[model samples]
Structures are given as C-alpha cells and as structure tokens.
Target chain A: MIKAEGLTKRFDDNLAVDGLTLNVERGEVFAFLGPNGAGKTTTVRLLAALIAPTDGRAWVNGYQIGEDNINVRRSVGILTEAPGLYERLDAVQNLTLFAKLCEVDDVAGQVEKYLRLLGLWERRAEPVGGFSKGMKQKLAIARALLHEPPLLFLDEPTAALDPEAARTVRDFIGEIKEAGRTIFLCTHNLDEADRLADRIGVIKQKLIQVDSPANLRHSLYGRRVVIHLASVTEPVRTAVSSLPFVEEMQQMDNALVISLDNPEEQNPILVERIVAAGGAIQFVNELRHSLEDIYFALIEEEDRETQA
Target chain B: MNGAKIGAIVEKEIADARKNRMIILSMALIPTLLVAMVLGTTFVMLNVESVDEASLDEDELSMIPAELSGLNPSHALLILLNDQFMFYFLLIPMMLPVYIAAYSIIGEKETKSLEPLLATPVSTSELLVAKSLAATIPAVVLTWLSFIVLIIGGYLIMPEPVFLAMIRPVWIVSMVLLSPLLALLSVFSGVIISSRMNDPRAAQQVTGIFVVPIIALSLVVLAGKIFLSVWMVFLAATIALAVDCVVLYFAVKLFQRETILTRWT
Candidate 1:
C-alpha cells in the first residue's frame, strides 16, 4: 500500500531523514522503531505528504506523495504524536469536524460510531481539554478512522497511555489489521511494536533496518543452546566448552550459557558431556534474543560504525 | 481547493466561535461601546447649558485646533467627536483581523492542531482564504453597523444642515467599502505575522501597530491640518488592498508544513 525509494529530508545543515526506503503491503502492520530524534516522525510526515521531500519519491495507495498529495491524503488517515486535537471542542465535535472535512456522507453517524467504538461515547460531550492523555489519544484515533481510509499513519499512538488504555489502543490497531487496513506506526515502544508489528523497521540517522522480529532476533545472536544447571562449577563450565560444536561458554549464575554455530545437532553431545563431567543438568533449551535485545544490539553496532 | 471543504472549515470555525460565548459577547460588546460613546458625547455636547470655563484649562484648550476655536461649544464638540469616531472606527477594521487571525493560526499551534489540519486533503489556498474571510467578514459587518449607529446619533444631535450633508456617498463608501478592504489587509497581515512569530500576543501587538497611521490621520483631521479628499482615501484603500495581496502571497509561500513541523516555535 506504500512504497518509497531513497527518501530523504534535509533542514538547512541537518539531515532529518536520509536515503531511507520502505514498503508496506496491504493489511500489514509496519512498526517504525527509533529513538526520539531518529527521523521516524519526519518519515511519517514525508509519507503523509505534509512536507515535500528533498529527494526521491514515495507512493501511497498508488498516489505519488508530493505530486498526487490530495489523492494520497484522501486515501490515508494520520494520527500525529501530540494528538493535535482542538482542546476547546468536545470529542464528538472534533471527530465530526474531521469527518466532514474528509467528506464523509453522514458525519454525525460516523462520529457516533467511532466515538462508541473507542469507548469515548460517555465523554464525547466534555471538552478535550478536560480529557486525560489516553482519552485524547483515543479521540485522535477516532478522528483518523472516521472516513475509514484504507491506510493509517500513527505516531506514538500509545505513548502515554496506562497499561489498560495502551492495550485498548493496541487491540484496536490489531482489529484494523484484521480488517485488512494498512498501518504505518512510528513508535519508540519496543514491546508495543513487538506485539503489533508484522515487520519492524529500526531507523537511525535516516537509514532503516527492516526485518521481521524473529529474523532480527536470529540474526543478532545466531543460534545458541542454553543449559540450566543446578550448579555452575569450574569443571562443569570447562566440560561444556570442550564439546566440539561449543564455540563459547559462560556461567550465568546457576545457568550454563553456551553459544554454538548449530545447536540442533550439538545439543545432545553438550548435554552428555556435561553429565559425564558430573554436572547435574536441570534443563536444556535454545536461546533466542527478544526484540529489545536485537534493537539495542543494532543501535550499538550503528554507534560503533559511526565512531570508527 | 473544493468549496465543500472550505465550507466545512468555515462552518466548524463559526460553531467554535459560537460556543465560546465570551468571544461572541466581546465582539458584540465592542461595537455597542462604540455606539454608546459616540451618542453619549454628542448628547452631552448638544444639551449642556453652560460651559465650565475651568474645565477648559490652557492645556486642554490648546489641544483643540485653532480653526475650530470660533465655533460654539456644540459645533466644536461635534468636530472633536467626529475625529474620535473616525479614530475609534479605524480600530474596528483591526479588531477581528488581529483577534481572529492570531487565534486561528497561533491558537492552532498552541493546541498542536495545526499539523493535523494541514495534513488533511484541504488545499493551502482554501485554508488561507477561509480563515481570511472568517476574520474579515465579521469585522466589516461590525464596522458598518457601528457607522450606521453613529450616523443616527449624529442626525439626532447635530443641526439639520450638518446632519444631511454628513451622509454623503463618499462617506458611506469609505465606511462600507474601504473598511472591509482594510480589514482584509489587517487579517492577512496578522495571519502572516502569527505564522512566523508563533507568539499570538506578539503577533497581535505587531499587527496592531498598523493602526497607528490611521490614528494619526484622525488626529490630523481633528487638528484641521488636513482634510482627506475622497480621491486620497480611495488611493489609500487601493494601496492597502494591493498590500493585502502581496502579504497573502508570502503567507502562502512561508506556510510550508515542513517549516512548521521542524521549527520548535
């Protein structure tokens, strides 16, 4: 539903988003992960056609970003980081205003439906200024979805929400995905991305590292075998390292952590060697890095490269 | 730049203005105060039985123009009130432009709603024109309404010859036609200033400075140092309208969403 090639944005001397390419398929939930100033928001704005690119081009739903901006805007919904709501207007009024602007046929009905869906029906009449952060965020979502656009751009939708509210937003996002809507989410929340994204893209310095969470995890640590030993003694550690396929061994408290090139065939031999060395084995399992670990590792690698 | 979208924005702005009872009330109250002040001064001048010689100290007397000195107290008072009326009405063109334009742009910035509004399918031309009209229309209406009241009050207190002569085609054109054009100029200027400054008050204060020249013109008229010819007034209005177009063009050019998104202000 979205395509970009060598997309870049420069502000005077600073390059905010540079030479980044990304593609999101229809009905896919794509999470963009980056630190505070890693050009995530800039990328979202570029995709939304809210700003002209300094170079390259992007297409949303077949409409070129800057050239066919109006058509692209009509086909997409955007929820910005700060929610950007008119605080003086009530939730219902805010939704209705945007719905009408989007040229919805029946604005009042759409407003009612979205407010009820977001569980904001009760507070629809209260000024948005009086709402909590979570409420305002939900209202922003409702505004974005009012016209039922095929694609959505959400920037930090769940940033300040409590666990329950955050879950509600995540679930709503999941529902949108299930209903076959493309979502481009820009967030710093790794857990949120891990749970909701089909593919996660880590952006830093205007470049992007895009892969599935599982593949990223696999690439970060390769294949490894973890053995849970009742005790970690010098003999047990030495014995595990002596195995043919065992590349490295470290005693992690009571657990013996081993890294190997291939853990599938070497697991049995490693366990047998540990047993033979008189080390009591409690359990043996393969270790895979989580999204958080992969993210930090990639960022660390980028920092090292820049420093060098 | 579809009409439906512009209409939607205008409708939303009007509804918002309505809900803020204070804004509506203040808009209404300002003109009423102008009417009251004009009529009250006219009545006091026409009806006062005797002059307080003490009230006209040397400083106050010197402030009155020498040309107006030979006239009776009522005539002199009418000239003075006419000048004050012109000065205060100049402010009318400024009121909605400065207040609404500043609030429209800077308020959106403060509330963080500007980016989303720009992100929508609405064209820049539509958005700018809608806001400019929204601010300019009400101001022009209020200025004309206030002038009507001033004319009525002038008729009741001033002598018949002066009253009939006061309601001239040129005077009516000045109040009705020229006032709105000036109001548009001020509104667009205010919008441009607010877009750049981000501080609503400072934008307002800076735009408010434009009224200084008009106030000074009023003072010159009151002093009888100059009488504004109809041609001169028309020329001034034309110049203001041209300036409006120029400022509006810059406003559109500088209104790039990228600058707003990147700049902290």
Candidate 2:
C-alpha cells in the first residue's frame, strides 16, 4: 500500500530523513521505531504529503507523494503526535469538522459512530480542552478514522495512555489491520511495535533499517537454549560443554542455560546426554531475542559506525 | 478551492471563535466602549461651554468654523462632534480586524491545532481564505454597526439639519467598505507574521505594528491635512486589496506543514 525509494529530507544543512527505502503492504501494521529526533515524525509527514521530500519518491495507495499529494491525502488518515485538536470544540464537533473536510456523506452519523467506537460517546459534548491526555488521544484517533480511509498514519497514538487505555488503542489498531487497512505507525514503544507490527523499521539520523522483527532478532543474536535441570553439577556442565553442538553453558541456582550452535539439530541429542548423565530435566526451551534487544543493538551499532 | 471544503473550514472557525467567549466579548465590548467614550466626551464638552457669551473671542468662534453659522448651541456641538470625533472613533474599529485575524492564526498555533488542520484534505488556499473571510466579515459588520450608532448618538445629542446631511453615503462607504479592505490587509499580514514566528507574543506584538499606519491615516484625515475623497478611498481600498492578495499568496507558499512540524520550538 506504501512504497518509498531513497526518501531523504534535508533542512538547510541537516538531513532529517536519510535515503530510506521501505514498503508496507495492505492490511499490514508497520511500526517505525526510533528515538527522539530519529526522523520518524519527518517520515510520517513526508508520507502524508505535508511536506515535499528533498530526494527520492513515495507512493501511497498508488498516488505519488508530491505529485498526487491531494489524492494521497484524501486516501489517508493521519493522527499527529500532539493530538492536534481544537480544545474549544467537543469530541463530536472535532470529528464532524474533519468528516466535512474529508467530504464524507452523513458527517454527523459518522462522527457519532466513531465517537461511540472510541468509547468517547459519554463525553462527546464536553469541550476537549477538559479531557485527559488519553481521552484526547482517543478523539484524535476517531478523527483520523472518521472518513474510513484505507491508509492510516499514526504517530505515538498511544504514547501517554494508561495501560488499559493503551490496550484499547492497540486493540483498535488491530481492528484496523483486520479490516484490511494499511497502517504506518511511528512510535518509541518497543512493546507496542512488538505487539502490533508485522515488520519494524528502526531509524537513526537519516538512515532506516527495515526488517521483520523476527529476522532482526535473529540477526542481532543467534538462537540459544534454556534447560531447567533438577540439579546442576560440575560433571553435567563439563559434559554439556564437550558436546560439539554446545558452545557455552552457565549454571544458575538449579538450572542450566546453554547456548547452542543449532538448537533444532542439537537440543534432542543434548537432552539424551543430560539423561544419560543421570540428570533429570523438568523443562527445556529456546530463547528468542526480542525487538527491544535488536533495536538497541542496531542503534548502538549505528552510533559506533558514526564514531568510527 | 472547492466551495464545500471552504464552507466547512469557515463553519469550524466560526464555531471555535464563538466558543472562545472571552475573545468574542472583548471584541464586542472594546468597540462599544470606544464609541461611548467618543460620545461621552462630546456631550461633556458641549455642556461645558462658557456661560458669558461676551467673553468668547473671535479666534474661538473661528475654531467653530463657518459651518456652524446660524446654528443653535446644539447644532454647533453636533458639527464639532462629526468634525473632531468621527475619525478617531473609526480608528478603533479598523484596529479590531488586525487583532482578530492575527489572533486567529497565532492563537491556533499557540494551542497547537494548526498542524492537524494542515494535515486535513482541505487545500491550503481554502484554509487561508476561510480564516481571512471569517476575520474580515465580522470586522466589516461591526464597523458599520458602530458607525450607525455613532450617527444616532450625534443626532440625539444635537439635533441639526446639517448633521443629517453630514451622514453621507461616502462616509459610510469609507468606514464599512474601505476599512474592511484595510483590515484584510492587516489580517493577511498578521497571519504571515504569526506563522513565521514561534513566540505568540512576538507575533502579536509585531503584527500589532500594522495599526501604526491606521493611526497615522486617522490623524491625517482628522487633522484636515488630507480630505478623504471617494476616489482616494477607492484607490486606498484597491491598493489594500491588492496587497492582501499578495500577502495571502505568500502565506500559502510559506505554509509548509512539514516545515511547521519540524521547526516547532
């Protein structure tokens, strides 16, 4: 649904978004993970056609970013980081205004429906200025979805929400994905990205590293195994280390943690070795690297490259 | 720009402005107070005339002008009110549009709603045009309404035939039409200034400087150094309207949504 090639944005002397190429498929939740000033927001603005890209090109739903900007905007919904809402207007009025701008038919009904869906129906009449941060965020989401656009650009949509509120937002995002809408979510929350993103892009400076979360995790750290043993003795440790497939082993209290060369080929043999050695195992598991680990590792790697 | 989108923008702005009760009340109340002050001073000056007619000098009589010849005390007071008070009174109304428009854009930025508005499907031209219209329309209406009230107050204080004739259609044209064109110029200028500056106070203070020209014009017109002819008023309006168009064009050109989001301090 979205394609970007060598997309770069420069502000005077500083390049905010570097030559980054990425793609997001229809019905996919793509998370843009970055720290502060990592060009995440800049990338979002570029896709939304709010600014012209200095280099490269992007297409959203087949509409070119700069050339068919208006059409692209018409086909996309954007929720900015700050929840840009008219505080004087109530939640319903805010959605109604956006609906009219989007040229939606039956704006009032759409506004009401979105308000109810976001659980903001009870406070629809109160001015948004008085709303809590989470409430304002929900209203912003409702505004973005008011016209049912096929593409959604969300920047920190659940940034300041309580856990429950954040979950509600995340679930709503899941529903959008289930409905086959394309989502490009810019966020700093690794957990949110881990839960919602089908593919994750880590951006630092102007460069972007795009990969599936699983692939990134594997690249950052090779697979390892966790063995919960009834007892960890010196003989078992030495024996496990003697196995050609075992690279390293560490004994904790009563458990043995082993780093395997290839868990699929080595785990069953290692289990037999443990049993043959008169060791009883209560549980055995593989440890997969998480998105957070990969994210930090990549960012640290980028920092080192710059320093070098 | 499509009319429907522009209409939507206009409706939203008007609704937002209405909800800002303090601003609306201030906009309404300032003009009323200005008119009251002008009329109140006129009444006081008229009533405080010298009790001794013999002590009145030829110079003071000349100050009253040949226009007051063969008129009663009340007629003389009416002539003085129009000749002296009307220009400054109109100055207040002219300044209102500048403040209203400047605040409209700058205030939105201060509140951080401008980015979301720019993110919408509505075109840049539509947003600027709608905001400009919303600010200018009320300014024009209020100026004309205040002018009517001024005329009524003048007539009530001093009933005179010449006073009725002095309420020329040309004078109404200058206040109602020309003033708003000038207001539009101020508003567009103010929007540009506000958009470029991050500090709302700085934006407001800088744009408030446009009122200097209006004040100067008021002084010149009131001092009789420049007789405001219909052609002159029309020329000024035309010039102002042209400047408004140019400023509006630049405002749209400089208003990059990405730039705003990135450069936000």
Candidate 3:
C-alpha cells in the first residue's frame, strides 16, 4: 500500500532520509527499524504527507504525497510518537472531536466501538489526564482507527512506556495486524519488531535492507545447528569436519556448533556418520539469532563500508 | 475549508475551554471583576460629585459643545465620563482574547498535538479560522455581557439622558461592531505569535503588546484630544476589519506545515 522511489528528505544541511526506495504490500506488518535521528520518524512523516519530501516521490494508499496531500491524509491513519491528547478533555469528548474531523458516519457508534475494544469503555467519561500511559496510548490507537483507514502509520507507538504499557501497545498492534490492515511501524525496539513484523526494513537514513525476518537471518548467518554429543573426540571432529555439507564446526566441550546451509536435509546423514565415528547424539536444535544481533551487525557493516 | 470541520474545532475548544482554568480566568473572572469594579467605582464618583458639588468646576461645564447644549449640565458631564469609560470596555474584548489565543496555539506545540490534527483532512485556513473563531466567541460574549451591566448600572444611577448616552450610536457601534473586530484582531495576532513561540507565557507577553496601543488610545480619548463621532467609529471598525485581513494573511503564511513539523520544537 506504500511505494517510494528515491525518497529523500533534507533539512537545510542534514539529510534525514536518503534515497529510500521501498514497497509495502497490502495487509503486511512492515516495521521500520532505525535508531534515534535515523529517519524513522522522518520517513513516517514523509509517507503520511505530514511533511513534504525534499526530492523524489511516494504514493500512500495510491495517493501521491505532495500532489494529493488531503487525499493522502484521508487514506491513512497516523499514531504519532507522542500521545498528544487534550488532557483536560474526557475520553469520549476527545474521540468525538477526531471522529467529526474524520467525518465518520456513525461518530458515536465508532467512538464507542474503539473505546470498548481497547477496554477503555469504563473510563470513557473521565478526563484522559487521569489515565495511565498505557490507557492514553490505547486511546491514541483508538483515535488512529476511528475512521478505519486502510494504511496505519505508527511512529514509535510504545516509546518511553513501562514494560507493561509497552506490552499492551504491542498487543494492540498485533490485534490491528489480525484485522488485515497495512501497518507501517517505525520503532527502535528490535524485540517488538522481531515479534510483530512480517517484514522489517533496517534503515540508516537509507534503505539498507528490506526482507522478511527469516530471510534476513538466513542470509546474514546461514543455518547453524547445535548437536549435543556425549563427548567430543578427534575422530568425531574429523568425521563432522570432513563432510562436504558442513561449512564450519566449533568444538564446545560436548556440543558441536556446526554451520551448514541445509541442516535439515544434511542432519540425518551427518548423524549416521557421527554414529559410525562412535559419538552419542543427545539433542539437536537450530541456533537462533535475535533481531538485535542482525541489526547491529548490519549497522556496523554499513558504517565500515561508509568509512572505507 | 470545510465548515463542519471548522465547527468541530470550535466545538472542541468550547468544551475544552469550559474546563480550562486559564480560559475561565480570562473569559469569566477578569470580566466579572472588571464589570463590578467599573460600576462600583462609577457610583462612588457620582456620590462624591453630589456631595462635593462646590469643589467641582462648574466653569468646565461650559466646555460641553453647543451641539450638546440641550443636555443638562451634570448629565452632559456624565455623558463625557461614560464615553471615556466606554473606551475601556474595548479592553474587555481586546484583553480576553490575548490570553485565549496565546494559550490555544502554543499549548498545542508544548503538548505536541498539532501533528495528528494536521494529519487530518483539515486545511491550514480551516484550522486557523476555527481557532480564531473559538477564541473570539468568549471575548465577544463577555464584552457584550459587561456592556449590558455597564448600561443597566448607568440607567439605575443616572438621569435618563445620561443613561441614553450609554447607548449612543458611536458607543453601540464600537461595542457591537468594533469590539468583535477588535477581538478578532487580538486572536489572529495571538495565533501568529503563539504558534511561533514555545512558551505560552512568552506568547502571551508578546501578544500583550496589542493592549499597549489600546490603552494609549484610551488615554488619548480620556484627554479629549479627539471627539469620537459615529463616522469615526465606523472608520475605526473598517480599519480594524482590514487589519484583521492582513494579520490573517500573515498568520497563514507564517504557519507553514513543514516549518511547524520540522523546525518548531
């Protein structure tokens, strides 16, 4: 639902987002992972048509950014990093105000729907100033969904919240994804992105990589399997290392950290060799890589390349 | 600019202002106290005039122009005093909006609420107009309400002609026509200054510059440098309306969406 070609935004001398070409499919949870001042928020603002791009072009929900700002805004919902609610206004009053702005047909019914869905119905009459961070964030989420815009742009929706509040926001994001809406999530929380995103675009004012989490991990580290052996011996090491399928092997006491591209297809044959080599296999499982590891590795690699 | 969207903003501001202490203090408390003090002090001046008639200069009474020769001597003096006091009433509309407009825009900046609002389909003109209208309403309402109390108080205490002077064409035009225009003037200027600045107090202080010229004008009128006639009232209203247009243009130009999103803190 979002497409950008060489999208660049420059503020005087500093380039915020540079040459970011990307496409987000319908009903996909696309997480924009970047550090502070790395153009995540700037990218969100560009796509939402809240700010105009310095160069290049983008289409959000099929509406061009600068050419069709009003239509572009109408086609998408945005949850800004800050809650930015009118503190003195009650929850119902706040929702009603935005509902009218969005020209929602059943304003009262829709406001009630989101409020109840977010579990905030009981306190709908109270001033939002009295709400907790989680409650206020939920109210913000409700505001974004008030008009049911197909594309939702969420910029750091859970930033600075406590663990529980952040979890609530993540859970809400999960629910939004289940409803088949396209979400463009901008965040620095790798864990949140890893758990929630169908595809993640790691960025540093430029599109470094964009792919599904699984594909990124496989490309970066290949496939590694941990084989728990009763004991490690010279014959076992020679047997495992001599195999054509094994890329690398590390001896860690009784566990062999074996690196191979196709561990699933090659594992049974390797086990037969290990058995013939007189090694007892205990358990075997594929090693896992967290998004943080991939994120930092990619960032460091980019920095070294830039320096080079 | 959609009228319904503008109405929604105005409606929201009214509901929010009802609970806002700054709005309440500026719109309600200040005007209430000013009305009471103005009427109370006018009664005192009138009482002391009756008791100390000899000390009062009867010779100055001749200065009442030949046009007003038909009026009673004391009532003519009451008319001039009422006219001078009426100039201060303009302050009611002028001063109240200074606070409201200052708080309206800068409060949005400090709270970081403008982005989401801008993300909606509403245009810049619509948002600014809505805020201007919302701030102007209370100022105009309180000005009229205070003017009513001033008129009724004059009616009860003074002679019929002196009370009639309170509703003179110039005063009515100034109150009914010029006061709202004056309030719009304050609101638009306030919106400009408030949107650009981060501190509400700083915004209010800067917008407070609007009151200086009004006060100076009051002093000029009080000193009898120029007699205000119906034509002058209309002329002043015309000028104010024109200036409102100019300020509104600058306000819209200064309120750049990109500048606000990127540059404004």
Candidate 4:
C-alpha cells in the first residue's frame, strides 16, 4: 500500500530523513524501529504527504506523494506522536470536525463507530481539556480511523500512556490488523512492535535491516536451540557435542544451549541422540532472541560503524 | 476548495471564540468603549452652548470648514466631531480582528493541534481562506453594529439638520465599503505575522503596529489639515483593497506546511 524510493528530506543543512527506501505490502503490519532523531516522524510525514520529500519520491495508495497530494492525503490515516487534538472541543466535536475534513459520508455515524470502537463513546460530550493522555491518544486514533482509510501511519502509537491504556491501544491495533488493513507503525516500544508487527524494519538514517521477527533473529545469530536436562552427565554432553549438526554447545546450569544450522529440521535428530544417550529431557525450545537484543546490538554496531 | 471543510473550520473557530473569555471580553468591551466615546462626544456637541463661547473666538469655529460654517455652534461642532470621528470606525476593522487572527494558527501550533489538522485533505488555501473569513466576518459585523449605534446615538442628541449632514454619502461609503476592506487588511496582516511568529503575543504586538497609519490619518483629519470627501473614501478603499490582496497572497505563501512545521520555532 505504501512505497518509497530514495526518499530524502533535508531541512537546509540538516537531513531529517535520508534516502529511505522501503515497500510495505497490503495487510502487513510494518513496524519502523530507530533511535531518537532517526527520521521516523519525518518519514511518516513524507509518506503521508503532509510534507513533500526534498529530493526523492514516495507513493501512497497508488498516488505519488507530491504529485497527487490531496488524493494521497485522503488515502491514509495518520496518528501523530502528539495526539494534537483540540482541547477546548469535546471528544465528539473533535472527531466530527476531522470527519468533516476527511469528507466522511455520514460524519456522526462514522464518528460514533470509531468512538465506540476505541471505548470513547461514554466521554464524547466532555471537553478534551480534562481528558487523560491515554484518553486523548485514543481519541486521536479514533479521529484517524473515522474516515476508514486503507493505510495507517502511526508515529509512536503508545508513547506516554500507562500500561493498561497501552495494552488497550495495542489490542485495538491488533483488531485493525485483523481487518486486513496496512499499518505503518513507528514505535520506540520494542515489545509492542515485537508482538504486533508482521515484519519489522530496523532503520537509522537508512534502512539497516528488514525482515520478520523470527527471520531477523535467525539472520543475526544463526539457529540456536535450548534444552532443559533432568541431569547433565559428561557422557551425554560428550555425545551431544559429537552430533554433526551441533556446530557449538554451551552448558548453563542444568540446561544445555546448542547452536546449530537449520534447527527446525535437525532438532529431532539431535533430541533423539540425546535421549538415546540416557539424557532425560524435561523441556526443549528454540533460543529466540528478543527484538530488544537485536535493536541495541544493531544500533551500537551502526554507531561504531559511523564512528569508524 | 471544499466548502464543507471551510465551513467546518469557520464554525469551529466561531464556537471556540464564543467560549474564549479573553476573546469575548475584547469583542464586547471594544464596542462598548467605542459607544461610550461616541455618546460622550455627542453629548458635548449638543451642550456646546452651555460652555463659554466668549473665551473661544470665531477662528476656532472657522476650523470647522467653509462649507459647514453656515450651521450654528452646536450643529457645526456635531458635524466637525462626527466627520473626524469617522476615523475611529477604522479602528473597529483593524482592532477586533487582530485579537482573533493573531491567534488563528499560532494558537493551534502552541496547542500542538496543527499537525493532525494539516494531515487531513484540506489544502493550505482552503484553511487560510476559512481562517480569514472566521476573523473577518465577526469583526465586520461587530464594527457595523457599533457604527450604527454611534450614528443613531449622535442623531438622538444632535439637531435634525446636523444629523442629516452627518449621515451623508462619505460616512456611508466609509462604513459599508472601507470598513470591511480595512478589516480584511487587519486580518490578513495578522495572519501573515502569526504565520511567521510563534508567540501569539508577538504576532498581535506586531500586528498592532498597523493601526499607526489609521491613527495618523485620524490625527491629520482632526487637525483640519484635510477634509474627508467621498472621493477620498473611494481612494482609500481602492488602496486598501490592493493592499489586502498583496498581504493575503503573502499570508498564503508564507503559511507553507513545511515552514509552519519546521521553521516557525
């Protein structure tokens, strides 16, 4: 639903978004991960046609970013980092105003649907000035979805919300994903992105890496499997290490961690050999790397590379 | 330009204005002050005979102008004061909208609401035009209403002949034509300033400088340096119309999405 090629935005001498190129497929939840000042918000603006790219080109829902700007703007929903709501106006009024701007067929009906969906129907009449941050953010999300655009660009979807409110927003995002909509999510919350994103794009000034969560872990640190042992004996350890698929092995406490290539296919062979060697197995699972691990490693690596 | 979007923006701005105590106070109090000034001047004109005419000579009365010299002292004073006070009507167009247009965009930026509003499909042209109308409509309406009160209050106290002369073509054109144009000038000028400045107070203070020219013209007229004729009113209207077009063009140009988002700070 969204494509960008060499998308660069330069404000005088400072480059905000530098040569970002990526394609997000339909019904895919693509999460963009980066450090502070990594051009996430600027990229969202360029894609949404809120601001034109300085040198490169981008397309949203089949319209070029700067060429058919109105169509592009109409085709996407954007929830900015700040809620950016009208505080003096009530919740319903804010949604209704955006609905009118987006040219929704039935403003009130569209507003009612999203407000109820985001659990804001009860406080629609109260002024937004007194609303909590999470309430305001939900209302902002509802405002973005009021017109029912096919693509959504959310910048830091859950920046400052409490845990419960963040979970509510995350669940709502999952619901949106289930409805077969394309979501371009920019978030600093690694756990939320790890759970919600179908594919994650780790970026800093450029596209560092893009892959599925599992694929990213595999590509970063090959295949690794963790096995819980009833008891570890020198014979079982020596036998497991002798297996050809076992490229490396380490014993931590009562568990054995072994690194292998293609563990999904070779794991049965390795487990059978361990069981045949009188090794009583209690638990066996793949050693999955969390997104936080990959995120910091990649960022630190990039910083070192930049300094070099 | 979608009328629905423009209308919605205008409607929201008007609603906000109604709820804003500072804006409401300025709108209400400015007109009341104008009314008080008008009425106080009218009462003094009506009671000019009670003052000592012996102390003041005919030269002071001759300052009223050769054409208006045929009238009695009270009548001449009413016509003189009425003609010079027409300049005060210019303040309405320039003053009221400054309070409003000064806060139009900068207020939203400060409140962090401009981003999402800009993210919508509404273009810059539609947004600026809607804001211009939002500031201009109320100002022109309140100005005309206050002018009507000033006129009627003058007529109630002054004699019939003086009232008839005061409500001539010049003041009519000034109110109907010149006032609205001046109000547009004020609004667009405020929009231009607010587009560049972050602080609403800074925008308003800079926009308040525009009133200097109108005040200067008022002072010149009061000093008997020149009398305002219908032709002069038309000339001022034509000049104001051209200036409004230029200022509005710059307002639209300077209010770029990137500039507003990135450079205003």
Q: What DockQ does each prediction reach against the true complex?
A: 0.64, 0.71, 0.84, 0.83
- Find the 10 residues in a row with the least total lDDT in model 4 chain A: A201-210
lDDT of 2 at A292: 80
TM-score of chain B of each: 0.84, 0.80, 0.90, 0.93
| lDDT value, residue A63 of candidate 3 | 92
Model 2 chain B: ten consecutive residues of lowest lDDT = B50-59
Better of 2 and 4 by DockQ: 4
Where does candidate 1 stray beyond 4 Å?
A229-254, A258-285, B19-26, B50-80, B152-159
Position A306, candidate 2: lDDT = 88
lDDT for each residue of candidate 3 in A151-183, tens digit (9 for 90 to 100): 999988898899999998899899899999999
Candidate 2 - CAPRI tier?
medium
DockQ of 3: 0.84
- Highest-scoring model, DockQ: 3
Candidate that beats the other on lDDT, 2 or 4, i.e. the better one? 4
Q: Write the per-residue lDDT of candidate 2 for residues B27-88, one digit (tens) a residue.
A: 78867986797678767766776333355566545544454455663555455556455555
Candidate 1, A12-88: lDDT as tens digits: 88888889888899999999998888999889998999889999989999999989998998899999988889887
Q: Which CAPRI quality tier does the interface of model 4 achieve?
A: high
Q: What TM-score quantifies how close candidate 3 is to the native fold? A: 0.96
lDDT of 4 by residue, A1-308 (tens): 88899999988888888788899999999999999888998899889888888888888999999999999989999999899887888998888889999999999899889888878889989989999988999999998898899999999989989998898899989999999999999999999999999999988878788899888888888878899998988988988999887889999998999999887788898889888999999999988888999998888888899899
When sorted by DockQ, best at the front, the candidate numbers are 3, 4, 2, 1
